[model samples]
Each structure stands twice: as C-alpha cells, then as structure tokens.
Target: MLNSEFIATVEGDKVPRKYFDGRGMYIYVQPSGAKYWRLKYRYEGLEKTYAMGVYPRVSLEIAREKTEEAKQLLIQGIDPNEYKKNQGFEIVAREWFENKKDGWKSRHAQVVIDSLEKDVFPYLGARNLSAIRPPELLTIIRRIEKRGASRVAEKVLQRIRAIFRYGIQTGRAKNNPASELTGVIKTQKVQHRKALPIEELPAFIQDVKNYEGMTSTRNAILLMLLTFVRTDELRSATWDEINLEEKVWHIQGDRTKMERPHIVPLSHQAISLLKELPSYPSKGYLFEGRKAGHSISDKTMIHALYRMGYKNKATIHGFRGVASTVLNESRLYSVDVIERQLAHIDGNATRRAYNHAQYLPERETMMQWWADYLDEAQGINQVGIVGRLKGLFSR
Candidate 1:
C-alpha cells in the first residue's frame, strides 16, 4: 500500500486543494506545484490527521511509513495525533529543561544551554520522536568526548535522558534512546585536591597579590577564595545581595548549588575588599563582567594567578579547599558551624535543620586571619584602604 513513485510524482489533481488517495493518506498540491503528504485518521471517533512533512523532503515511501505508524498507534488505543506530537521529544525536552533551570546557578544554566545547542539540537533536533536511536545518543556523547570535554559529554547525556523520560510520560517519544546509553562512556572521576595548608598560606598570598589583572577581577577572585562559595554564586553576585552592616552576603537560591538561599557572614576582610572596588559605571552587580549584564569570566582569577607565577601550583577553587582544611583542622568552630559557614549541607537532621547562621565570632576572626595572611604574602603592611573600608562595616 505504501509505494514510492505514487507519492513521489505529483500528477492528476481533481481539485486545486488536495485529496486523500487511499489508506487515509492525502496528497496536497501547492500553488507552485510542490507536493506534500499528510495522513488522515481518526481515534476515539475523533477526526484527526498528521502532517507527514513536505514532499521530496519526506519522500513517498517515508510518508507511507509515517501513515502506517500513525495507524499502528491508533490501533494501540493511542491517539495518532498525540503520538505524533509526542514523537518530537526534543520540543518536550526543551520545555522541561527551561522549567528545571530556574534554580540552576547562572553559570550552570549557560553551560547547559551551550551544550544542548551544540550537541543534541544539531543531530536530533528536528528528528521525529520515533527516529532517535540509542546508538545515536552514544554517538552524540562520543562526539563531546572526542572534543576532550568528557565531563560535559556525560552531563549532556544525562540531560537528554531526562528529556526522553519526560517525552515518555507525555506520550511523545516511544522509547528513551538515552536510557540504553548507560555505562557506554567512561567519565573521569573529579576529586578535588585539598588546598595547600594555612601554614603555607602567607607564602601563597604574597605570590598572588603581585599578579596583575583588572582590579575588579583581582578583587573578585580574592573574594571567592576568601568566601569559598561556588564559582557562579560569586560571579553573578549583585550589590543588593550584600549587607556591609550585617557583614553578610545573602546569595539567592537560584544562584546557589543547593537550590536554597544561603547567608554568608562575610569577614571584615572580605567586606573591605568589596568596599574598595571602584564604583560600577552603572548600578547592579557587585562585580559586573565586561558584558553589561553577565558575570565576569571564571578564568579571570586563575589567569591572574598564572600571571603571578602560581600556574599549575594554585587554583581559585583551591581557596575553598584551603579554607575548609584550615578551619576544620583548627577546631576553632564546631563542624556544624564551619559547615554552615561554608554553605555546605550535611545529611544529618540537626545540620539540615540548622536554621540560624553560625560561626560569627570565629568566622570573623578567621576572615581577618586570611586577610592578614594575604597581606603578609603580598608583603604589604595594610590591606584595602583600612579606615575607608571598615567605615562601611556597620551598615
């Protein structure tokens, strides 16, 4: 019943419109003589038909296959139109992605968006629901892997699978091609190296302050190292998020890794750094990127360090590692207090239930100590326009 030539060559037309030849498949004639195939069908006694795509682009044989597939779904008690819509899993997946991304950190949102655009959308963006195969998913991930972004490759696969699962629930995709792709690719384990000890911290700080970059970037990097918040939370930080008086930075939930708001009681030292930053040409983010609205590049700080000769030896993230190491080893604050100050959540009930911020006294002291360390390393006796910075302290 599904023939190629019959659907391919457009000939006799009884009307200027279109006509269903047989088996409920219609041949549509255009003003310019282009032909298109559509399948006419009914489900639950409701009349419905599906666009089989344009002729030549969707050949006669392909149209027939699509028609038969629709009929099969109808026979299976699923509305063919519904199934056809569901078949375009990518559309459903994208909708799902947007909905879930509301709480993702800004940096994460950008990365995920870039990954989907470059990898998934190109190969399978327009493919019908029934078309994507597991082998195809493997190939897509392998392509990302070949580019040396193995972690990103695996993450893209996970997001794609989430979309397929959504498609299955909505009756768009038949089976998850991504579901069968488990264990197909090997991902390198990410083990964060502990930061070099506080004992060696002064030496490290002196090394860093000597490096050169835009003053704002240098300040932002030092702040991140001191605060130990996630990369994104720091970069997307807004002026409104700070309270120099309260000595805290309330990172909004959307920018936090935990998908919950965090209150960072900034040490006097950190606040000093913020206060010393030049007034923004425009008002908004604390550290606005070169772009009007976006945050500064994550690499800016690391590059600063590299220029200062800490290349391959120190990292911006290492600041957190160092902070966690020193504070925890010193036992200056309870594990809970340090964890909370660190904006880290532990699985224990009490820790999770810790509603009030802790470690105020000790954190203030540690922050000062960290600042002193950096000053010592940089061989500077004073830090961040002391009186001017401290004046903004109470508010």
Candidate 2:
C-alpha cells in the first residue's frame, strides 16, 4: 500500500523503491526522496502502462485522475495499450505506401520515393501521423514547387493525401490535411512534344539508307517506320506477335490504349525486311537491342537520325507525319479512314465500328504504294518516281 504521507517522508539517494497503489497503479520512491507516479492497467485484454509524472510534478490526486480516465476507456472495450502502439508514423507510412504502389506507374513511383526522401522524411518522419496538418503539407509541397517542379509538387501533394488518408483509416490521424489544397497551389499543364513536318521527307529517308551508322541504329529506325506505332508499343513488341507469312502484326491491348488487339496489316516490303533481320526467330523483341531482353532505347532512334545528317529537320518519328501527309495530300483515303489507320481517337464510335481494322483494303493499298514510293524515292530502282507512283492510283 502507498500513501501521500509515506511518499512525502520517503528518503532516497540513487535507487528507487516501488509501492503499489489501488487499481494497478504505483508510486516509485526515489533515493532522493522524490515520488514518481506510474499507472499499470489492462484494456481490451492486453497490458498497458502510462507514465503519470515525475516526482513532485504530478501530485498523488492528479495521478489518480489519469488512472481513472484510463480505466473508463477499459470499460468501453478499447485498448489503451494498442492505442499507444498505433500512434507511430513509421508503421503507418510503410503500410500506406505498400498498399499504393500497384496503382502507380514505374516513373510515378520513382517521383513519390524521391519527394518523400527530400521533403516529407526530413521534417515529418518522426512526427506522429495524427499530428500532421494541411499547412504542414503545404509547406512541403511549396518547397518542391519552389524548385520549379510544379508537376512533381502536385504529385507530392497527391502522395501526402494518400498518406493522410491511410493515417485516418488506421485511426492514427483525425483528418486528411491534403484535402482542399487546390486553391493553395497553382497547377500547370503538361505538354507533349510532337515530331516535325513531312514535306521534306524524301531526302531524309534517302539519307537513312545511305547514312554511315551501326546496324542496330539503322534497323530500329526502319522498323519504327514500318510499324508506325507508339515507341513503347513497338519497342516492347515480341517476335511472337509478328507473322511474316500472314503479313500481320498483332498488338495486344495490354500494350495498347484501346485495350483491344490491334492487328496491323504488314506490307509485302515489310515482310521482306523482317525476313532479313538477324535474329527475328532467336529473340523475344522483334527489334531486340543489346540490352538483354529490353527493347531498343529511344536514344538509338534519336542518334540514328543525327548520324543521317537530319540534326533538327527530320526524326524517326517524322515518318508517321510523312506517311500521313502524303496519304492525305494525294487524297487516296478519306479523313476518317486515314485517322482510323493512324490509330487516332475516332470522333464517331459508330463509324469506327464499320472499320474495326481501319479500312484494311484501302490502307493495304496505301501502305504498299507508300513502300514502293519509298523504294523509288531512295533511287533503289532505276525507274523514275512518276513511273512507280502510277501503280499507286486507286483502281
């Protein structure tokens, strides 16, 4: 048993003596004649303890009040012990980020990791998740924006929102501080860089064939031209998707935007080129690069055009523009037909259904004619351009 009179009279120098109070509480009598109060209790079937106060700072009556409050929580079936354990950021942040990784792209995941390292961890890593506020999050996000990374700043804000949401769900935070932050920060638009024009294409294509360069560089450019698909779609393509005999290239929806198999009707000339490829049968990538199983780098395409003496005027991607320009210029196909073949978003879903494969007959004729024109344009044949283009006229 412990009493205030005994606590007041206790004398100590270094070692402390323990005295149990009623209701699983205790008062420690230090060797220096000081008494510290500690409360021991069980809530929700688990053991827990709370420090009441150091000697003289909290009186015996004050300590009893804290013990009584903790007791009431026990009566309500809540665990104060578990509550204390849950009040940590390290545990919450880990669980939060793990559940979120699947929804992010690889590049996006990298940015989140970088921002947390540079912004959140330094200041908030040690703080309890429940303690963070909107103003606190604004301070961190503003720092990222100050470095001229507005987009990254927005991403950081989103990441913080997710963290706080996790904190709230886990009973660690009261509310998400990152909400209602749109007016606090200004958002900037993201622009995509597009390839150049097509009128100056004949000379550029000629230069590629005759340009002095590595075999891989030249072949990758040529393959990109033949496929006329997104760089990622083409680079990640496998040999299994290509059928030279059938003259068809199938791109599964996982690799495409529409989430449907996009079957590109290969031109006869395209098949001949693939047949001559060094390892079409041996490798996974049809354009297998030197980097293990991964596709060729975009740099290869960029550098190849550089070597071909098209420093700025033309690019590997410019071929698409060239094809579209020539096809539309000659009026060989309707706008809807051309747009569908280009895999552009259709304005009319009904018309798009008519050509699930994008006016295949006309596109085949157009692609073949375009290939023949390229051959003649490169002076591969002795015949003049006029003579070769004659066969391109719609029958």
Candidate 3:
C-alpha cells in the first residue's frame, strides 16, 4: 500500500521503477525524478495503461479515486484514455500552446497566453476546432475592435490563426478561420513618443535640475539626456557593463532593442555624474531600487516626467527622439554614425559584421561635443572661447 509519506519519499534512480498502489494502480518514477500515477489494466485481454496525473498534484487519495473511476469505466467496456483523447478545444489549444510557448521569451509568452485567455479562449476555447469558421472568428475580432484595441484584435487574430494551423497539422481542424481576417479590420495609427521641442531644451533641463525628487531620479533623468539610451536599457544596467577607467558603457546584444551589442562612449560629464552617484552594498545594478537584488521600477522615469509637469508633453522614451533630431539637425555627424549610435537596424548585415570599430573615433568626438553643447544650452558654460575672443577684439 502506498501512503502519502511513501509517495513523497520515493527516490528515483537511473532506471525507471514502478511501485504498485494495489488494484493495478502504480506510481512510476523516471530517472529525471518525475513521478506519474498510472493504471495498468487489461482491456479485452490486451494490457494497457492510463495516465492518472503526476504525483503531489494528483495526491494519493485523488489517484486512488481516479483508479476506482477507471475500474468502473472498464466494467462498462469503455477506455478512459480514449475518452480523454477525444476531448477538444481546451486540450488541443493547450497542446499547441505547450508546443510553441518554449520558443518565445517568458514575458512575451505570458502576454500571448494572457491575450488568448482574456480574448480568444473565452469565446472559442471550448468549441471544436473543425467547427470554427471565418465568420465566427471575424465576429470575435470585430468585438475586440469595438473596444478600441485594433492592435490587440489583430494580434489575437494571428494567435488564433496559428492555433488553427496547428490544429490542421494535427488533424484536429481542417481550415483556418483567422486567415480570412486580413483587411477586414482597421489598424491604429503608429504614435511616436512625444518629445519637447529643441527650443524647450533649456527650460526642460533647468526644470529637471530644480525638480524636487529622489536624488537617484534626478541623476537618472540627467543620465538619460546624456546617454539617450532606452529607459529599460539604463534601468537594468549592471555595474559590470560600465568601465569607469575606459569611459565606455558596453551594452550586450541581449539588452538592446536592436538585439546587437552596442558600445556607448561616455562623455566627461557622464563619467563624473556616475562617480558622484551614491554606491549601495549591491555591486550589481548601478541604479539600485528600494528592494535589494532588483533594479528601479519601469515607471520611475515616467513618474519623474509627470511630476516635472511634462505629462503628455514628453515621455522618457522621447529622449531618443530628441537625440536623433538634434544630432541630425547638427549635420556634424554622418547618418550612418547617428543611426548606429541610436541602435537602429540598417539591414546591412555585411557592414555591421566587419565594422565593430565603425566610427569609434568620430563617435568619441561627437559624444564629447554633444555633452559640451548640452552644457552651453543649460548655461553651464557662459560662452565659447571664440565668442569671448571676438568680443575682446571688437572692443
């Protein structure tokens, strides 16, 4: 007899071994340490087994009850396994989800599943796959669009289409209803991040300096202005990525939006600002959060912007736009250099491969110049040497 304690204490070895729970039910332990409860019964004189969930989750009492239920089904000339295999929708959707979820990153996979659960599953999850048609899918999609989430509606359509395609491959469905949704729905206009006008930079910079907030938050904003990197890129930055002596911040490909490793040449101001930042016990994140072992919240910068009266006028991401616009307008750097610095995709694989040192010298010069220009804009330096010299000569 298998009790809860025995079930819990069973150790798995290299070879799989089965311990009988009596009445043809046994717990099979695999070398990987997975325990599965199964019923070994002869159906029409042929031996077969029915999977009765995994251990702990199924528990001893539940497994026994399931075994008893299977015995009753056997008495009536029915197979529980076959009956379960015939079940549709939820089972098949999960089958497809489990098959493909591993390919997506955890966060992306969770979003996909959440979309399905909230939008797709409730409407069509329990329905037989083969029975679903284009009209039914369109109705669901239109309902989503009615709620003003055209993008979400489109994404749901794609997920449903993929699920149906998976169903078709597995003989669970014959046609994809979601395939017919193309051009049936409207797409929302792409909204770029709102940036303060270049003329507003002086006022914005001054306001940021005067803004009464956490010292860390003020430094974060200043760092964003100097670096022009993405909010998350800076938020999740670790101390190892920064070389104070070398004056370079190396961002690995995994952390970048373009999925390519980037080298950011730090300006003198940036290096000084970093040196002045208060160090925490954690040698990990440069910008440590309130909690240990975690970086600052994603909303930290946004909340700062809101507090500074820039809500709806500018966004944390808008700093990238400011850099792109100001750099392009200056015409002091090549488009290639600016775009590469911005980490934009150029579709030139060959150039990207061979040009790891592309414009490093130019970028170092440009970054320093940009920092000096920002200082001048904020009146950190009164006037250029040339202007002062011209004034003296004129007198």
Candidate 4:
C-alpha cells in the first residue's frame, strides 16, 4: 500500500516514527534519516514485527511485493517472523552439536561429527531446519542403507533425530520430522561374536597351541578362555588385580561392562599360564603390548584368530560362549553359579545389590571343574587339574 512519493516525502523526526502505508505495513523513519520498510501483525494475540528491507534501495513497489508475500504467509497461519528466524539445517545442527559434544566421550564426539559431515550435511545442510519433511530424511537414511551400512544408517538416523529435537526445543522448528520415521528403516540383524561349537573345542584348542603368533597374544587367548572374561577386561588386566597366593583375579567395576566388580577363581592351569607370562617391572598390565606401558590391542587377538584359520569360525569372545554352553551342558553347576562366573546381570534388583558374592563358594568348585574340562579337551594331563573333589555328580 506504500507509495513512492509519500515514502520519499517522509521526513526524519527527533525520534523514530512509523509512516503508515496501511494494513500492517509502514516505512520506519529514524532520527538519523534512515528509512526501513517493516510489517506489523498479530499472531496468537502477540504483536510481531518483520523487517522487509531498507529505504529507496528497496523501492516502494518492491516493499509492497514483500509485504503482500508476508500477508499470504500470515493467511496460511504461518508466523513470518518465526519463519525468518528458523535457520538452515547445517547451522542449527552445528549449534546442537556444540551444546552436546561436551557430554560425550572424545572418540564418540568425533564419530558423530564425521557421520554428520559425511552422511547428512552434503544433502540437506542448506535447507531450512523446519522445511525438511519426513520423506526427505528417509531418502538420506536410505542412501546409507543402500551401501549395506545398515548400522551406520541407524546411527545417522539417531543423530538426525537428536538434531531435530534440539531445533524443536529451541523454537527454531515447529515439529520433528524424524519422529515420523519410526519403524521405517528395517532393523539390522545383530551379529554375535563367532565361537566354536562344543564338539569342535578339542580341534580348536590344538589349533591355538599350534598358532605362530606372539607369545603374549597366545597367552591372552588362553587366559581369556580359562577365565571366560570379556576380551577388553583380559586385554586391560593389571598384575595387582591378580593374587597368585589367593588364586583369585579381582576386576574392578569400572573396567566391567555391567559396572560391577567381578572375581575370577584361578585354577592351577590359569595360575601356571600367569607364571609363564614375561614380566615388565615398569608396567602393570598382565599382557603388555609391544608399545611401552600399554596393554595388547584388540586387533592382535583378532588377527591371530584369522591367521589360525578360524577367521569366521570362531572369535576370542566366542570362548565365553563355548565355556557357557559346555558348563551348562555338563550340569555339574547351578545356573546362578555359571552366570555369576560369566558376570552376567541378575534380574532381581535387590538380589543384585546383595548377590555380588552370591555364588562364590559354588563358583570356585565350578571354575575348577571348567578348567579340568578344558584340560581334558586339550589332551593335557596336568596334575590337580584332574583331581577329584566333593559332590562331583550331585545336582
């Protein structure tokens, strides 16, 4: 509704004043002689102002056009001011990342940034945060799935949802489009670590003994099988945690996945293996890596298994599964005793708190039985390994 003559004729005042152009549009004249085209409107009973442009640079006709466009947006129930404030996906996503990265581990934070840069930013980075619809995000995730990286796609989807949630909470976006994508991507099947079947244990044990890898890696594998502890726990084991006289290996809660302390009863075989391990007086690890003061890398064990021709057939972690299956099949121990030795969670909360040492006595017997079972399986005739004990056949 603004005219060029009236806009040009509008004089500066002592204070900023609006020269009405009719219907929520005006030319704001400042005391310093600067004029700006602005629109005033009510949205949800709250008054909001949107700046169209500056002075004659934005001619009366151009200002009128912008005002009409804003009116059309208002008619559609959109708040023009909010629409203008909503930033692009990349901008808002980086903001969200900055706010959240502090709480994440350094490696985890790096992975998230890499995922966003590689998978998300290239396609939809410049698009408005609120303007991107659900189907569009589905296309992005499906691109990752097409490469057979279903797990990466799932993680990318999670990151996208988190970014969208941040945008919504900050009032930059009205709704979460990613939420509409629930159940859209097919869940990837989880692949458990490969372990040998019980019947194949004897042959596998022979292959391990015949392996030509480093003695440290070999010891790691044997100790892992003997203790049935997690691979990382074995890799990071310190000498102080093991008491050769007590025949016990005590792992603290922080190192465990369940964040609970675990005690492993060492059999004579395990004790002999520990004694055979070469010592570094300066280092604390039971299995020290080639690098000074560091434990063995996970890849060392993995590649050792591959070189032993058990690449897909078995894993170091599979030893736990092998032990669990064989122990349960033997029926010489109770489920709680086996599970306690395995360091698995107890379902009952009250029991879990008090049951830290629940089956320690039975576990001692069960661990010795398991070690003897492994000795016989490997054709080793070590003394005390085959020594008979109390209630060998009782339920």
Candidate 5:
C-alpha cells in the first residue's frame, strides 16, 4: 500500500522504477523525476498497459478507482482504452473546459459549465461527438428560447461551437454541427443598462446617502459611482491595489474586462470614501463577504439599489452610463480623456498601447471634477467645478 507521504518522498534514480499497488496498477518513476500512473492488464490472452494519468495530479485514490473501472470493463468483455477513444460528448466537453478554463475568470468558467450541464448535457451529452447533427442541437436551443431566455440560448450555442472546435482540434470530432446553426435562432434585441437621468441624479444621490443597509454595501455603491469602474473590479479590489498617497487604484490586467492593466485617478472624495470603508486598512479584499476570505456577492450592490426603491429605474452598472453622459454633456473634458478615465478600450490597437497613461494629468483633473459633481449633487455645496457644470445642464 502507498500513502501520500511515501509518494511525496519518492525520488528518481539513474534507472527507472515501478512501484506496484496490486490489481495491475502501479506508479512508474522515470530517471528524469517524472512520475506516471499505469495499469497493467491482459485482454484476450494479450498483455497490455494503459496510461491512467500523472501523479500528484492523478493521486493514488483516483488511480485505484481507475483500476476498478478497468476491471469492470474487462468483466463485461470491453476494452477500457477502446472506450476512452470513443468517449461521449459530455466527457470531451469536460476535458476541453479543464484545458481552457485557466485563461478565463472563475465566475465565467462556472457559468459556462453550469449552462452546459443544465441545458446541453441532458440531451446530447451521452451521444457520440460525430453522431450529433444540427437539427438535434437546435431542438435543445429552441427549448431554451421557448422559456424566454433568448440571450442564454445564444450564449449556449456559442459555447457548443467552441466545444466542437476543441473536439476537432483534439481529433475527437470530425464536423461541427453547432457552427451552421449560428443565425438560426431568435436573438433578443440589445438593451443598454438603465441609468438615472441627469435631472434625477440629485434624488438618487440623496437616497444612496440615506441608504439603510450594511455600511460596506453603501460604501461600495459610492465607490462605484465615483470610480465608475466595473462592478467586479471594484468589489474584488484588494487593499494593496490602492495607493492613497499616489491617489490611484492600480487595477491588474487579469481583473479588467479588457485584460490590460488600468490606472484609475482617485478623487479626493473617492479617497475619503475609501478611508471610511470597514476593510480600509485590512490586508485582504476591500469588501469581505459573509464567507471568510471571499469578496462580497455580486448581487450586494444591486440588491441594495432595489431596497432603496430603484428596482427597474437604475442598476449598479448604470452608474458608468450616468458618468459618461454627464461628462460628455458638460463639454469640459476631451473625449479621449473621458474614455481613458472610464477604461474604455480604444478601437485602434497601436493607439491603445500608448493611451493608458497618456492623459494622466487631464484625467486626474477630470476625476476630481466628476467626484465634486457628485458631492454637489449630494448637497455638499462645493462650488468650483460643480457649480459651473450645474449651470451648463438643467437640474
């Protein structure tokens, strides 16, 4: 019997070694310090070896389970290797997800797998990759559309296409049935997020100031309004990312929607709000959830808005739209500066490379002005930039 401690301590020698665990399963160690799990078996009077997987990745327990599964196949007069070669769609999709999930955010990866399990796998999962045709896949998509989830239906189709593409690259599939069905489904019209009109901004600000929820949740809404960064970027922010002396929030590339590093010029008001947060001086995430070591749930800010009576009238994301509208309407800042401050990606690749920090000074001024605008709306009565901007627009 092999224990994890013994396996962890095993070292390679000049010659390769095999440690058997009985029932034809063993760990093979190479001279190069590589360890692999293999199963030795006999089928039809011929000796064969199947490569289970590599260790620590494939632990001793999983290797034993594979051994039992192989024995069951042998009892039923089937070859485990043959079954693996002709694996069903579900198996291949899961393998593809594991291979590709490293590049995606955790939340997005979960959504992809959940969609496949809920709407895709029940019908087509057991079928062979090559056997599933366009019509059969369409039926499942139509079922989703019938339930008024046209957007989800479209996303499911896109995932199926990507899965089939992975299958072909891995030599597990010949043709992609989902490719031809792209435009066949009914897609819902694009609806922009609802933003409170500029006229209604003062009242919304008052409601948020008077919000009676968790103090952290209230601070989150205020931060989002001030920074206008993406919801995930703000909520998942760590204390180390903030440089109070530098007046900046350095968002790492992995956290941004554009997958590029972004610099936010924090306003005086934004800085004051940050100092008042419960986790301001903490070493971990800015907003700690009920679960230890995790950030607050994505629904926290939105649900806070609902409680404040802004159910369909506004959204957390809507704050970005409101800021853009107010800034563009104010005509006090350049388009490029406003866009860069908002972290909007530039369409031109060459220009985008150099534009992230191009307008730092102007952006600092604009961010401060925007923050002051919000403060004035909240009845703080700062009259420098906010007073001028207020005169430019009604209410």
Candidate 6:
C-alpha cells in the first residue's frame, strides 16, 4: 500500500520506476521525475495498463477509487478501457451535436446544446450510454415534466433519443432507452398565435399606418404585413439581401428556419416602403437596433404592437398566420405558389432544392395583388377595387 507521504517523497532514478499501491495500481515515475497514476490489470488473458491521472492531481484516494471502479467493470466482464473510450452519455451526445449542428442555425444550435447541458448532462453525463435503462431515462424526463415544463421535457426526450441512436450507430450503446419512453409525458396543447380576422384586416392596416410609434417600428410592422416573413428574418435583414434592381429579397440559407435559401419577390409597394426607409449604411441591417452592430431586439416590434393597443388581439408572428389564411382562402393562386412565397419547406427534398424561384412570375403577380389589396383596405378607395378584393376573398 502507498501513502500520500510516500508518493510525495518518491524520487525517480536514471530508469523509470513503478511504486506499487497494491491491487494492480501503482505510480509510474519517469527518469525526469514526472509521475503518473496507472492501473495494471488483466482482462480474460491479456494484461493491460490504464492511465489514471498524474500524481498530485489524482491523489491516492481518488486513484484507489478509480481502480475499484475498473475492478467492478472487470467483474461484469466489461473492459474498463473500452468503456472509457465509448460509453459516456455526455461524450456521445456532444459528438452527435457537433456532427449535426453545422446544418442548423446558430441560435438553434445553441438551444440544442443548452438543453443537453442544462437538462440532461448533470444527471446522466458520466453514466455508460448502454447502461442507462428506459426507467432510468424516464425518471430524468419525468423530473423535467414535474417542473411544469412539459414542452421542454418532450424536446429533451427527443434529443436523448437522437443521442442514443447515434450511440448505437457508433457502437457506443446497444439500446436506445429513450425510444421506449416516448409519449410517456403529456403533450401540451398547441396554441396558435392570435391573428386578426380577415374582415379585420382593413382596420388593422389602418391602425398600423396611423401608429405613432417610432418610424422604424411602424415601417417594420408594415413590411411584416407586406412580406409576411418571420420576425427574426425581418429584423435581421441586411441591406445586401435586398436587390432593388432584381426586385427580389434573397434570404440566405443560414438566415432562414428551413436552412434553405429563399427568394421573396418584392411587390411595388414593398419596394416603395424600402425606398422610404431612413438612410442606413449599405452593409448594415435594414432595421438596426440601438446597439452598434446588432439588429433590433426580438421584442421591439411586439412591444410596439402592445403600445398600439393590439395586445392579445395581434402578435408579430400572427401576421404570417393572417397572410397564410387570407391567401389560401382567396384561392387566387396555387397552393404551391402560396407556400413557396411564404418560404414553407416542401416535403419533397428534390422539389424544395430546385424550387426556390419556382413560379417566380406568378409569385410576382400574387405579391403585387396582395399589396394592391392592402392599399384598398387602407382607405385608398379606388372604384371597384374594394369590390374586386371583397369578391375575390368572399369564398
């Protein structure tokens, strides 16, 4: 047996030396006096040595504990070195995340990692992936559900399932415990965002035009209605993304939710609104925030809506819902065209890949019609204009 005093005072000779701590554990000392903790063990027939840690950092007690853990693995006919190489839940989860995160948006990637770190890692990080049974994982998930975060619990479960699948593919795990735990938690009811009714569009459009908020916020609201792009997409819009000459807003794949590039055909009215914006640097965001280089906060437009007395009646995301509802009900365009303009991903990967600019001419016409319809709704009374839109959407 070795004591801390013996370890601290041990000296190295011209040749490397091993001072035994009993039970196949020893401190290996180099000729230059560097020392490391190691375990000498046999599995089946072959002899093996596993490095525990360097001397001081891994004290005698800790080294002994590690040796005991390895011995326990040996008792179960498992190789300690092999388990260390491939069995940690946290290690496998992180590898899976790194392999897949490049295709995800930066914010979404952060969210995936954050969920694992905050919810899953602390409890199961060091456990062997193959050793975590269904009940064990369900216990952790149920803990999250008990905290009243059913949605987060569901997402964590899905992520855990993915990790185990990756583990199986990589030979780190034999079974996916999370797979059997699906639907064990309650599903949260889906609450759609509050969108103004089609009949209320005229009033809502009028109120937005008359909004006495910051000019930029008012413009942001109006543009959101006109384009119906997601809030983040609109807020983060750079001047470079808008091509005035081509009458298109080219959103790069990384900026979109679907991780595919999308093209928004600019309506005449939309281009006019762009022209009216306050002069900003060509390289900066169209809707710049108070911060030097960042776009407006996500809450900027929503807070402005709240200030306009539309709280609960309308939301920033609700604009997309409103657009989708009216456009689909009008039946003035094909479903494909409408969905493409909204940047909704097509389920067919082959079609989605080649359809970024599909129906460009029809989309242009539809967008212009949408803009013209909005103009009529905003009290721009053109004889028969209101009647035509009313009749078009009457169905």
Residue pairs of candidate 4 with colliding backbone atoms: none
Considering every candidate listed, which one attains the maximal TM-score?
1
Tell me the whole-model lDDT of each prediction, alpha carbons only.
0.71, 0.69, 0.80, 0.82, 0.85, 0.85
State the weakest 10-residue window (summed lDDT) of model 2: 386-395
**Candidate that would win on lDDT:** 5
46-145, model 4: which lDDT tens digit per residue? 9989888788777888778778978988999999877765578998999999999898644346668989999999998977786688989999999999
| Candidate 3 Cα errors over 4 Å, as ranges | 1-38, 41-50, 53-189, 280-282, 347-357, 380-395
> Runs in model 5 with CA error above 4 Å?
1-81, 84-86, 104-119, 139-155, 184-186, 192-194, 197-200, 230-264, 271-300, 311-313, 340-361, 379-390
Instruction: Indicate the residue-level lDDT of 11 in model 6.
Output: 88
Q: Given candidate 1, what's the lDDT at residue 151?
A: 62
| TM-score per model over all chains | 0.63, 0.53, 0.54, 0.51, 0.61, 0.58
The TM-score that candidate 5 achieves is 0.61
lDDT of 6 by residue, 1-395 (tens): 89999889888899999999899999999988899999999998999998787878678998998899889999999999988876789999999999999887565577689889998899999887866789888888889988878867877898999999999999777788898986798876787889976667777777788988777888989999999998878998888889998999988776676767888999999999998887444677787677776678889999988887889998999988878877887888899999988888789999877865679999999998888878877764444545665777776
lDDT of 5 by residue, 1-395 (tens): 77878777899989999998899899999988899999999999999998887898788898898789789999999988887666678989999899989987565577689899999999988776865789988999999999988767887898899889988998778899999896978857877889986767777887888998887788888889999999989988888889999999998775676767899999999999889887879778888887887788889999999999999999999899999989888888899988987888889999877764658999899999999888777764334435555677754
Q: Please list the Cα RMSD from the true structure of every candidate, rounded to 1 decimal place.
A: 8.8, 10.0, 14.5, 12.0, 14.8, 10.4
Q: For candidate 1, lDDT tens digit of each residue in 1-395?
A: 53566655656455555757679898788756677788777777777767888877777667777888878877789887665554565677678778878876555577677778888888888777666778888889988888777766877888898888887776666688888988977767786744554545655655555556677787787788778887767877877788888888888775566667887777767877888877432346778667876668767767777787777777777788777765565455577677776777787778567656565777666666655645544553334333322333333
RMSD of 6: 10.4
Q: lDDT at 242 for candidate 6?
A: 91
The better candidate by lDDT, 5 or 6, is 5
Residue-pair clashes per candidate: 8, 3, 0, 0, 0, 0
Clashes of 2: 3
